[model samples]
Target: MRHYFSDIFLRKAVIALSGLLMLAGGAAAREFTVNTISDEKGNARTPVISDTGLVAWQAYSLHDGDTPVHQRVDVLSAPPNTRRSDIIIWQDGKTNNLTATDTRLTGRCEQPVVGGNAVAFLAWFKNETDLGMPFTLSIPDKTDEMKQMESDYPTLFDPPKPPPVSTVEAEAGEAAPPPEPETPEAAATNGLNENLQRQMWRDSGQAADIVYYNTARGQLERLTSGNRHYCSPVVSDAGVAFQCARGWPYGYEMVAWPASATNLVQLTTNYYYVLHPDLHGNELVFQGWDGNDYEIFRYRFDTGQMEQITNNSFDDTAPVVWDGRIAWVGYPTITAEIFYWADGALRKISERTEDNTAPSIWEGQVVWQAYDDTDMEIYYFNGRRTIKLTSNTWDDLAPQIRDGLITWMSYVDNWDSEIMAFDLSDNIAVQLTNNEFEDSYPQTAGGKIVWQTIGAEGSFIQMAVPAAAP
Candidate 1:
């Protein structure tokens, strides 16, 4: 009887040890609330986490008391988020005093990117416009254009029919000779740049500008002024660079204001639909629409010259650049692929034809969203091998990588989003958040993760730590 009891006890010990081992091997995730408000109306989105466990995010008033009315999309549907939005900072598990609600009136604060000791964000100045300006489109010779149009007009037909015959320039097989050098005005009026048309919508009011927060000084400084609407401000120790939204058919252009200079310099103004810019040091890379299709472009701030990295007619966009290399998503057909550029050569990084996009780069590695499964999955490519980070049925999208660590948003059972992280070294994919509500746009650097979430009660900026170390 004693021997039988001893044998049972030994079996139980083995089972308990096995359970502990399994628990240790599994990805362990924990949460830390970075920002919460008294009203609990702060709906935060797109929080950036740094290597030192510092987090910055943009939050808008949940206005908890106000009845939720389908969340506004149109100008008339709701007030500008700027009025309710502010930037929040979280450090050492405590919400910091650094809030970007410096404006007294209703305004917006968005896309807070943390780099080193400074946090760069997007902010609207209520009635204030940006002082620095972007380059304007060169005006064409209207008088000459008017005369040409008058001469080219055909006699009106009963039904305004097409021209009876092809114009001299339109004759097939015999192409028109390229025009000789002309004045800038005449050239501007010419259709040479007709491809640079604006394809996106324009807002009624002015756009938001970039604002920099000095965490060390605890001071907020406006980096850009009323010139144009800017998006995705990438900051390095050098300074800040972003895409400025120009009027339609022109789309957005890359612009920058160096730390040494007060005036904003237009990096690209020639009409291409430049968008989705990322910068590292004095080198900048962005995707642009060259009339017929989208292509990736690289620009050097010191040299003031830009190179067309990808010339294909397919749409290549959402480029991320670092250490003079770039990666972007290229859509050849309905589906998309990943493309990378390095050392003056560009190559297809992703061979899959399914929809893949929203690429981010770290060191020399690249990460993107791949729609291989029912929901989008995260993929990582380090030039040689492509690895799938997540295989869940739910969508995992908007991946960002830094130092081989990847972070993104994923939707699970209830369809509400959660923040996830994958450490490349350990190959452990950790679900950072298992929130009942939706959490999204997580940014990870080193071992830290930050994201935004909103529920019926309110909105918030959340963080996951020790994330800064891995």
Candidate 2:
């Protein structure tokens, strides 16, 4: 009886030792180095990395009473008058202020995207109408009649439209005569009111223009001029593509700077709005207005053809392109779902009832965040099957995949985000960062990850590389 009991105890000991060894091996596999790539004093945000280890971000100096606000797009704030945001580039262990030498660029540069030897961004200039002087109305004291008129028509101060021509006038061969000109006092009053209203809609008296840093030429180049609002720039080896506002009520059109082009080209003129353009090689994809909802529009520079990849009443948005494959979030029903286009056919990759959004695709792999009843979880779709990478209560958002390694910012403990990564080959998940600060917007390229970290000092750019990373 004693011999049999010893045999059973020894077998249990071996199994427990084997389990301990496996856990230690998994921990060792996740060990990596995290580095701060941007200057702490520069207050960097929106860091982007290229496949060649090139990094670019928007940096600005914050003064006293300056409240820093981080955003997925460009920073939206009334920045200090003494300083403006600029683009910073890091390459080969050295950093360069990309726009410091360009005196002509008197705007806040943001949204830097790097591809190959180019870094494209948006530079917002202060509107010419915005003088340093305080805005005031010098209208004389209102009489009782004037007060009554204002009370009767709340829009009395609005710029009035000209009266429509009568039917009799249209039937006549003579052209309809213009309305009498306004008095000087009336014109000044109307102009003041219009300017005040327009100023309210502007970005704190600023309008953006697309600009790029040509590292090959060692110079900064402005792609679009005339202070139009051009934003959401995506860079590629071919060139840059972005959306430009068509003025007035603010409709957007797709614009591109083709490879080796001296001038800008407007890709879409459908008068409808376009958003979130992704450029890869010679193919461009974006979500365009399609009467009822947004639909995917694919453009080919090689053939100069624009094809509507999706035609549905449901809204399709946030489309991303890799090689010839396209992935986007589609609202086939009331809930958002993941859809992809490949091999000249469309496929629905996700069937969740909850909202699934922010899909990133590479090769045949797709990764996105889906609301999994408990919290936002990261979901992965390989070429063959689908799998849930994370199942914790914490919210995992903005999953990006590159070279079989997926990275995202996972909100932890007290709503503070930390960067996390999962390797598809090894089927191992690892936390890339753990600190008191918030690390968000983890972008992956060539096995490297870059993100924006909000710290006590200010927001800065951080990069993480695995021990086995290429």
Candidate 3:
């Protein structure tokens, strides 16, 4: 019995020791040194890593004795463990070249050091009467000891191999293959034949406020010209409505043009500013500003009669009609509020604390831009309750809803503004543009979105198509 117990205890000890050995072997760390090829001038380069961890580099060459030469080189770095370095070269008044070299340099020390992982070596020479270009790098493999260390860690010094060349070809006597034909579904989805969102913007050109049209042709059409100052163009199947301002105090006269006619019919003779004209069936809902305040008004095309919808002393604007309700922005107090005209009664939707503007009604929900303690954000009211859509600290405004999706423009940072869309049902927001330029005032209709892109060339309308359903 004592011998059997000793045998069991020894087996247990052996099993515990083997488990610890395996754990230690798995935890052992690895060190690697990466080497890159130098240009013809013996200048090595470093690599650029993307957000996805992929690396890429371009090849460059040097000239020797007035003759051009070529060579292949690559930039490399460790996966994600250490700080990556960059190389920059300046010539004349501009940056002529930028590269990442294989040397790591220390601060406050100009001379190169031996046996350091990061060492920079600089070379300077004169060409004829001109001063030679100066080169600085960090990874100097000067001695055989450092060279042997690079050889032991082959991965660090291993250069990227060239892509394999293909030699397979079609037979000499074989006929060329026929081109593939397009499918009906693909043609319909990709073709520019469907109706898209159409809105107007003021171009700060000689033709101040031009009636801009965004169509299926993927281009903007300027309809009016020369000092007319046409603004606020809204389109429907029947026609387009606009406010043409000419003189002081920005006196605007409401006008409508049939889709087939070039001439516009002056709908209102008043010199007040009329804006935010939306067409529903044959009726038009717009906001007209007298010398004092703004009021929501409606016009019946068949009857040729204009009637005021809200007779309150507050400012009401941004009228959007959907599901037999006209949604607009009304300021009962100092804060801008949201109100909808339904069943011949006016009902307020948003809370009184926040200032709401740019209300759009679609699919039984009212979406608008509101400001709380922070910058502008988007909020939606579904008849019973209001919910904030975005929680970022930046400004997000100009909410437009179409086909069960809410599209808005958000400033991700001080310099980056993007167009984003959110599916109301699934509560999923998708970033559409990741550009550095400012993209704002996104309006969606049907399967497309149009926005104003503010870049170096000034503001212009840009369009984006929605992804097809999977």
Candidate 4:
């Protein structure tokens, strides 16, 4: 039987962090600090960290107090929409609210992916403006008999109506006075204003499109526009690759925005439900439906060609690309397994019967989580041997590897999770966080790791630097 061990459980049971720790056998002792990058007002989540120490994430802020009250009847009973999402970036001890600075971005902006100094994300209006047309609730006109009934039974038909309440007032438990009837001129002006507002929302540069911060020009640029949804953008040396909905029958197609270029290229016209695209260098990889099952597909930006890497009955999805190699999850039977494609050859690296998914590839190494009949465990492939990096009762998920350093999130319970890391060269595993808060979704890059922590106050982005071995 293979001996299994958990660093998190062992560290918590044995070692108590007192600023530093001394290791046995004269091994190097590690010391590091966890720094909070986001403020408490907005609950930050899903942070993306680049090699350049630039961190980007999505955060939700409280809605403004003075919200406009439309005269429409539906607006009176609509549920409160009191939170708005914005993309935030932190770099070099400075924080910038990217969505707040841009006047045109007037809705929920999220799903930020940072590469180098640039950040790419998706932004769309959260209001009726995203409908792309003026939305009007059709209220049936009351018949003459209804009007007579109201006139005859004034007490029952016309009870005192409560005043309309704004979101702030409702939260504060305060009642607001009803507004007076609008004049004909005021109604006309309001209608014109509504149309202008809709137009501005629709024409808001890159609404429902791929928006990215241009490092060269120091401004946000819209990669694609029009009324369509783009999903799962991945950044690389070539540029960004994402799946875009091309309407019905067409489904979704893969699109790419070349680095430092204004022109957009549609890499796939099949539009067969492409999802979770990953880009590295000039090669873009993703899983596309092929009528039978999902298969792995790769597109080369330099050659303008598409290649189908896998063609089995099983569904192969969530491909992550690095250099020219790709790693993903494939179901050989009823259980999922880790699969890899490199040097024009495909191989199943995982030998376990349990489910293995969310594979991350860097250089030639791959890391992912696998089920071991009890809970999830982290597994790794160091280009030769398959190694189990984590073995614990808790579920270890979202393993990311970069330059021989592997990071993952281990959950002690449904609401308690922590970040753990393993160094390949030293063959040492370390628990990076030990606190009451839930730390998860660890992403490693350029020897630096970033993750989000959820606490009672709010979720925040945190960065940790692992000390080098002495």
Candidate 5:
């Protein structure tokens, strides 16, 4: 008889062995001190530290209190399997509760640890009035306790490393000549090496939200600048599409730019809000308000013609296309539904129970984010069946599917938001970021994932390439 081990069992066994070894070796317990700083209003901000020396602090919300809201400071540390304690260094002002009357503020925490490794940190905030602003978390570097944790817990770390160079043939008696340089055609054909061909979009130089090729070289390009606006950006082989408000009464309009350095083209001239533009072949599909209600629309690139795909009164958004099919989120009545258009007919992908959004089509599968009892989770559409990918009680959204992988942002209760990727073929969801800071809006293309992260000064984009398989 042969005994088989499941992946769960193997992972638990490895963790158990590592813990036993660490205890037997008597590894020195590391100590961490967490410090928080608020704008001016003495609002409390959460801060966290990982064993790898990664430190991150949350940014207070602008609706919580006043801009220069009160600033409070605290320190916390504990050893492994020991009780943690917190010390308040500074405290001021009574906590406010109301939303309209209350002033929102922003704050951050900065923690440092010795030894180069990745560290994980936890933070907590106090809001006497409304639910506090959605907390943000970050990790400064992959050092200290975080590094050790990654080494000991291989399942948790997914660091990207360069692909190995292949050895070339040479004359046995002749000196080995330098390897031939890659031709442009060969580089372009290899999707992973087409970083130089990728285009970027930004609003302005100082804007917070930016979208660009994660693996592309050169200076960080701004997609949109001026005012904290713009939500999501979708890029295809021909152009880049995003939501902007340059000439609209509302704060959003679907816009696109050619792959080359061409001017932006406003796809929708509607005065109402428009969002979530996706490209399929020669058509641009998006969701927008047609003066009365939200609906799906498609614009042809060559014909300069526009058509409505969905005419329902409820809101419909998050459109994706692949293999001559269109998948999107539709509000049939009260519940949000997933629908797909194929063979001159529209079919509901889900059973019209869960609220689904952020649909992406890849390799004949439709991937989306669905709401459950606790938080949002990822789901996959396979022709006639739907499968749940994650069961954690955390908010996960903005799933981007490409090349058999699904990447998204997940928010844990005690940890900052992280960029996680799952391989559909292997059924393994691996976390690619462990920072105490927030990492959200994950977009994957050509094996690389890019997202936005909040830091000490402002927000910036972070890119991670997938590690080549052994």
Candidate 6:
């Protein structure tokens, strides 16, 4: 390899600046530190960490005395799991509180996902605004009502007076309230990355629409709407892919969009439902029902080529794609086991399936939750062999991997949980949190971990990193 002076100088400078130095071919041993992102007044949970060290979370702040009435989401840089002091919650720019108050905020926005550019969620808004060209529900005319009544009725002469109109019926066709001018903070981060394609949802139980936020152009473009449910959206640098349902089984089809929702692409519109899309540049992998059973499929964006990954008579689900390799749960013999697909070949990763599920892959390495007959443990795979990483009786679930760092949740119970991480470089897995609090939904990326912990005060997001970095 040719050595350039500027490249060598920059490499040294980056090592000095980030305080991270690695040996030639061995893994580096790292101590971990946890950083609190939100606490006290509100709860911050559902955080996602990007491979570049950026973190975003959804929080409910108790702006009032004890009620967490102020709901918002925030994103900040936490490369080394640095604690953020100047945190600002981002909300829709509608100043009339429609986005905050009147809308029936559902779990649609509950999925707080982050990628390279911005944080996205399912924004459930079901208020007067989205009700569409409103109409009055006026009482029937006096003469028309009297004639409609049967002559046999003795009370036909005495017309019943109309009761008070309901708040919803009365406000029909009412103009929306004027919004406040752009606040200094709102204008700054309104559409942080107007070019990055983001998937979001607007579900109100009765009605919903799946949409994508165009970061480069700052537009929330709708992909599908009208009496339907859509979810589990995954996006790559190329486009966004999600699953939609139109009630029953017709709605669960895999759909895609490039930069704008207007350029909508329905990858699968068959009778079977396609769910849980995993998108990684130029490739989209998901599992869908193929008439009789569920199997995994992959689609190439550049050439519009589609291929079935698994053909067995089992349910292949929850696939996560990284680069080109894919990992998912395959239910062979009805016993769920971790499986992988690479180089046109599908193979099982687990030695024996005792209910193994929730597999995630990064650069061909896999991690998953498995039950070794009695205890629930998280397992790891090095693309060659499999090993049980944890031997605890306590349940360790939802293990994620990135850059050799593995993270998962250790729960004594549902509310009493902890975030644990293991570094492949040093072959050391340490409990990142050990206290009287609830920490779960851990994700690993860029050699760092992010998760949420709920205490008496409120739920907060905490990040961990190898403690050697300054």
Q: Highest TM-score, which number?
A: 2
Relative to the unseen true structure, what is the C-alpha lDDT of residue 78 in candidate 6, on a scale of 0 to 100?
A: 23
Q: How close is every model to the real structure, measured as TM-score?
A: 0.70, 0.76, 0.48, 0.73, 0.47, 0.69
lDDT of 6 by residue, 1-470 (tens): 12111221111110110111232235544666566654544556677766656565655432234334223223232233222222122222111111233224442344545555433445554442443212121222334444455353323233342333456545755544545654343335556432121111212235544434434545444444434565776665566776766343133777676643245576775545678887777788998898678898899877889998888777888888887899998877768888888898778899764889888888999999899886677788888888777764577788889888888887744347777766667665566676687788998778878787776666766667566654
* Model 4, CA-based lDDT: 0.71
RMSD of each: 14.0, 14.1, 31.5, 14.1, 26.5, 16.1
lDDT of 1 by residue, 1-470 (tens): 01111111110010111111243465443222233321244455666766666677766553334554225433124443523566777776466635543653245567788766568877767556544333443433345644565466322111132222336426655544555664443454655431222111223355677777666667766766656667888876667788776554346777776664656777765555777777777778887777689888888777777888888768888888888888888887778888887898777877553788888887778888877746677777866767665665677778888866677777756468776666565555555555478778877775666566776655655545451223
Q: What lDDT, from 0 to 1, does candidate 1 have?
A: 0.63
lDDT of 2 by residue, 353-390 (tens): 38899999899789998987888887888876666766
Q: Write the per-residue lDDT of candidate 4 for residues 176-204, one digit (tens) a residue.
A: 76678654335544345543333433322
Worst 10 residues of 1 by lDDT: 8-17
RMSD of 2: 14.1
The candidate that achieves the highest lDDT relative to the unseen native structure? 2
Model 3 lowest lDDT segment of ten: 107-116
Rank ordering of all candidates by TM-score, starting from the highest: 2, 4, 1, 6, 3, 5
lDDT of 5 by residue, 139-215 (tens): 12444655676577443233332233333222334444456675655653545433332222212222223223211
At residue 369, what lDDT does model 2 achieve? 88
What is candidate 6's CA lDDT for residue 454?
A: 71
Model 4 Cα displacement at 400 (Å)?
A: 0.7
